[model samples]
Target chain A: MTATKEHVTIKGNKDGLVFLFNDHCEFPDLLSELQYKLEKSHQQILSGPTIDVHIKLGERELDVQQEEEIKKLVGHHGNLLIQSIESTPKEQIEKNIHQDLKIMNGIVRSGQSIHEDAPILFMGDVNPGGMISSNGDIYVMGALRGLAHAGKNGNKDAIIAASYMRPTQLRIANIVSRSPDESANEGAYMEFAYLDEDHMQVGKISELHKVRPVALQF
Target chain B: MGEAIVVTSGKGGVGKTTSSANIGTALAILGKKVCLVDTDIGLRNLDVVMGLENRIIYDLVDVIEENCRLAQALVKDKRFEELYFLPAAQTKDKDAVQPEDIKKIIESLKPDFDYIIIDCPAGIEGGFRNAVAGADRAIVVSTPEISSVRDADRVIGLLEGANIKNPKLIINRVRPNMMKSGDMMDIDEVCAILAIDLLGVVPDDQQVIKSGNIGEPTVMNPTSNAAVAYRNIARRILGDSVPLMNLDGKKGVFNKLKKIMGIG
Candidate 1:
C-alpha cells in the first residue's frame, strides 16, 4: 500500500507510547519535529509533570531488542509526555498484588528475586539461589529448593509452606534454619514450618495454622 | 539464512563459555562458516577457550562502536579455518555496548557466516540483553545442580517471554555414574522440570577444565566425553536427529525433545 500522507503512527512498547518515523523524514529532524508536534497536539498530556517518549530510527527491521532498549531507556527516566491510548504493562507477577505476592508459577530462577512488602505464596517450587522474602507469610505450592525467608522485618508470626520443602536454608522472622534434617528419600510430601511458641517446628503445609490470603492492591 | 545464537545461563558458572567455544568450533569443523561473538564483555574467555587469546588485537565493543572494521577485530580459530572469534573487551563494562550496537554487528554477520554463537554473560541484566540482541535462536546451558537448574528455568522463561521458542538445552557436566548411583539428578529428573528440549548431555569430564586452561575447546580433543557431547549438541542444533549420547545406553529421541520446548 502507498504510505499514508505524513504518516504519524502510535504504538505501545515496554516503556509507553512510541511514535515512529517513516522513510519520508530524517531521524534527527523527525525527533525534533515530534517534540514540536507533541507540544502543540493536546492539553491533557501537556498538563502532566513529565512524560516518556521512546524513538527509534533508520530502516532497521524493528525487532524485540530495539523495542526493549527503548523501553529500558524511557523507564530509566520518568513518566511519559503523551497520554497514549495504549499502556505499558507492569510485570504480571506484581499486578494488583500488594500486601502479599502470589507467584502462581514455581521454580523462581536466578536473577529473579521477589522482594515485596507482602507475603509470597508459590503454587510451585522455589529453586536454589532464587530468593523470596515477605512481611506476612511465605507459601510454595511445590518444593522449596531455593532460599525462603519469612518475617524479614522480624514478624515472628510469619510462616513458610511448601509441598516438598527441602530448601538450602529457611528463615522465619529473624530465626533461620541454617541446616535442617536430611531431606527424605521417600514420597516427598508437603510441609509447613513456623515458630511453634517461638520454637521452630514442621508439619504438613495444610495442617499448619494459616489464613488464606486474598489478593491485595498495589 | 545464517543466524547468531546466544548460549546463556541466567546464573553464573553454568558453562556458557565452554559451550560457546565447543559449538562454534564444531560448526566450523563441520565446514560451516561460523563466528563466535563473546558478549560476556569485561570477562571474555572465548578467545582463551579457542586457544587464541594471545591473538586478540581488537574486541567486539570496538567493532560495534565503529572504532574498527568487523574484519579487523575477528580472530581466526587456531584449529578450524572457518571459525572466527570476536572477543569482548576485558576492561570495559557491559553498558559500554548497547543492544542496538550488538544487533547491528550481528546483522552484518548474518550474511557472511553460517552460524554466529554469542557466549552471553550471566544474568538477565544489560549484558544478557545485549548478548541476545540480534540472535535468531538461543541455547540455555545449565547443569544438574538445583541452583543451575533454577537459573536455567528463569532463563528459559525470559526466552519464552521474548518469543524465542526454539531455545534448546545443553545440560553440561552431568555425571552419568552419579545419576546411576542416585547421587546426581538424572537427565529425566531435570527434563521433567525445566521442560525444554535436550540438545545433548555432557558427562562430567575432567578434560573440560584442562582444555580451558590450555585455551583449547574440549571438543577439539576427541577422547573427552565432553567433546562427544558437544559434537552431538552441534548436530542437534543443525536439525539433525542424532541420538542422545547415553553412557547408560537407555535414553530416547522422543523423550528428550518431548519435555523441553513442550514439543514432540
Candidate 2:
C-alpha cells in the first residue's frame, strides 16, 4: 500500500489486485521488490479469499526466463491467482505495428504491380519496370531495380530498404525521386530510402541507425 | 503423351512465327512427327513461313467451329513427310476461338504427333492466351532491343503465372557486330535480365530473311548459318545437350587467328 516503492507498486481495483513494474528498473531489484511487497500484503489481501493478480510490465519486453522468474516470485505466497501479464502501451503499439507485415517470396518481373496496405518483405529481385506500393515500410532482401512507393497512405515515417538499391524511381509520402544516371559500385551493400523533411533521402543502411526517430529507434 | 510447346513474344516482329516454323521443321526432319499450329488468328503468317499457304484448304477456326475435320484442316508439308501445318484463320479475329477450343484441338493432335508446336500471336491478349492454353511448355523469343526484352520479360511472367514451369528463352536477330560495338545487348546481357534458361541464339543472317520471302524455312537450307542454329535448337528440344553455336561472327574468327599468330 506504500506508493513510494521505486521499481514495483501494488494497487487494488474492482477487478483484482494489480502489480505495476517500471520498465527502466533492473530485473533483480524489481523481482525482490515484488516478492517483498506481495509477502507483506498477502495476509491482509488474502484474508477473505484468493484474489487475481494482474502483472503489468510497462514498455518492457518480457522474455520467457524473466516471465518464469516473476511467476515463481509471485506464486510463493500461494494466496493469489495470476490472471495475465499485460504489456505497456509502447510495447503493445510496437507489436501491432509489425503484425501487418506481408512477406513475398518470388521475383517481381517487368510490368508486374504489387500493392500492399501494410509493410512488405520481398525475398527476391525487383526487375526494371516493376512497381511496388505500400502504405507502410518496404524491405527487399534482394536487388531492387524497379519503382518502390512507400507511405502510400500519407505516412511520412515509412522507409524503403534493399540489399542493392538501384530503383528507377522512389516515392515516400508525396515526395518522389529518381535514380541517378550513373549507378553506384555493384556490391551487396544494403541501402535505405526515407523522407527527410520534404525530400527523399537515400543513404547506407548503417547510417540509418544513428539518426532514427524515437518511435523507430530499435 | 506428345509435348505441346508454344512459341510466344509479347511484342510484335520478334520472330515468333519464324522460330515456330524452323523449330517444327527441324524436328520433323529429324524423323519425329511434328505438327505446327498457327494461333495468330487474323494475323496468320506461319503458313507462309512454312511454304504451305497454297495448300491450306481449312483453317484452325474451321476445325474448332466443327466446319471441317481436324485432319482435313491440317496441311501436309512438301519437304518433310512427318511435318504438318495448321494454318490460322485470316478472315476472323482472335475472338473466333476460345482458350478451351484451342486446348481441345491440341489434345486431339497429341496422340498422332510427337511434337505439337503452337505459334502464338504478339501481345498478351485473347490470341496469346488461346495459343498458350494448350501448351505444356513455352519458348519466349526476344531481340537485343530494350523494348523487346522488356516485352519478353512480361511474357515470361505471364507464362509462369499460367503454370508453365521453367520456360526457355530464345534470343533472335542478334547481331554480333553490333554487340561488339556496344550498340546492341549480348546474349549474356539478355539472359541476365530475363533470368531464364537460354535455348538458342539466332544470328541476324540474311539467309533467314531470304528464306522467309521464298516461303521456305531457313532450316531447310543446311548451309545457312541460321539453319545450323535452328537445327541445334531442335536437337536441344529433343533432350540433347547441344553446345551453343558461336555467333560472334567475324570478330570471333579474327580473335582466333590472332591467337594462332601470337600477335597482340
Predicted structure with the largest lDDT when compared to the true one: 2
- TM-score winner among the candidates? 2
User: B92, model 2: CA deviation in Å?
Assistant: 1.1
Residue B98 local lDDT, model 2: 98
Per-residue accuracy of model 1 over B1-264 as CA lDDT, tens digit each:
688898998889878988999998888777889999999888887777778878889898889778889999998865677888888999898989998999999999888989999999988889988988888899988899877887788888788766677688888888777888888877887876676788888887889999899988888888777888888888878889877765753348765676364443
Model 2 chain B: weakest 10-residue lDDT segment is B255-264
lDDT of 2 by residue, B1-264 (tens): 789999998999999999999999999989999999999999999988888888889999999889999999999997887998899999999998999999999999999999999999999999999999999999999999989998998998899999999999999998888998877888887887788999999988899999999999999999988899999999999999977776655457677786466552
How many Å off is the CA of A188 in candidate 1? 3.7
Model 1's DockQ score = 0.28
Worst 10 residues of 1 chain B by lDDT: B255-264
> How good is the docking of model 2, by CAPRI class?
medium
TM-score of each: 0.61, 0.77
